[model samples]
Target: MFVFTPTPGTTWNLTVDNFTQALHRREGDEAYIHTHADAEGSYGPRDEHDWWFAFSATGESWAGTGSPAAGDHEGVALDEATAGAAAEFAAWVLRELVPPGAGMEYNTRVGMESGLPDEVLTENTVTELDAVFRKHLKASSS
Candidate 1:
């Protein structure tokens, strides 16, 4: 799991899993991300790749949906202010590498510990995040 604070108010948390590493597959017409990577020393049983993207403000969490190419997950509800950013971020991720699919999972991690500072989303932060995303996307794709 990786946590990024691109802007002051917004935070993105990315989780990665291998296609076969998940204990259970996504059920009921849900869309999923897939990937493969080699096993690390301590982590056991690894596969190619799988990933999920999410954002949060205060205690509220939001996830991206591939369908309709927007934001909001099945369980979490986002407020008006953060909704657009969350949707934009999610949609960006989905469009970048995640192919279109149904039942997209968002807000997959809510209770997980955060390592980012508490701050409001700022334009500078968003810009920083964009650079980071592009770098990561480039590296991963290669």
Candidate 2:
């Protein structure tokens, strides 16, 4: 049991720093919160964020804040808010499947991708992933 969802590439209605700060404040024992953004944002404009950063969870519980791995960008094409809306929809399906009292139990040091949605998602697994996001981006859409 236990399934997980991943965060979508949504442009939070906040400045980059503000978003980062907000994520820092978002910690809880209730669930795992994976937060990330374009790493290129650190070197370039606020809009041309292409470098992907996978972050790890620090302390107990996922606080949506952590340090990215040494490298950046997994080359996984994403649909951010300014881009396509697939991530938004994938997030929706996973959220709809979540039941009460669901949250991630494991703390991971490895970052990049969350093994979620499996090949097929079920309500049973959805409730188990804890508070996963973007639970369906990697699914087989055939």
Candidate 2: stretches off by over 4 Å = 1-12, 26-52, 57-141
Alpha carbon deviation, residue 113, candidate 2 (Å): 17
Q: Count the backbone clashes (under 3 Å) in each candidate.
A: 15, 8
Model 1 regions lying over 4 Å from their true place? 1-81, 100-103, 108-142
Q: Estimate TM-scores for all models.
A: 0.21, 0.23
Taking the tens digit of each residue's C-alpha lDDT, what string does model 1 give over 89-123? 43444333333232223321221232222222222
lDDT by residue (tens digit), candidate 2, 39-84: 6534322323222222222222211222222213211222222101
TM-score of 1: 0.21
Of candidate 1, the 10-residue stretch with the lowest lDDT total is 66-75
Cα error, residue 37 of model 1, in Å, equals 20
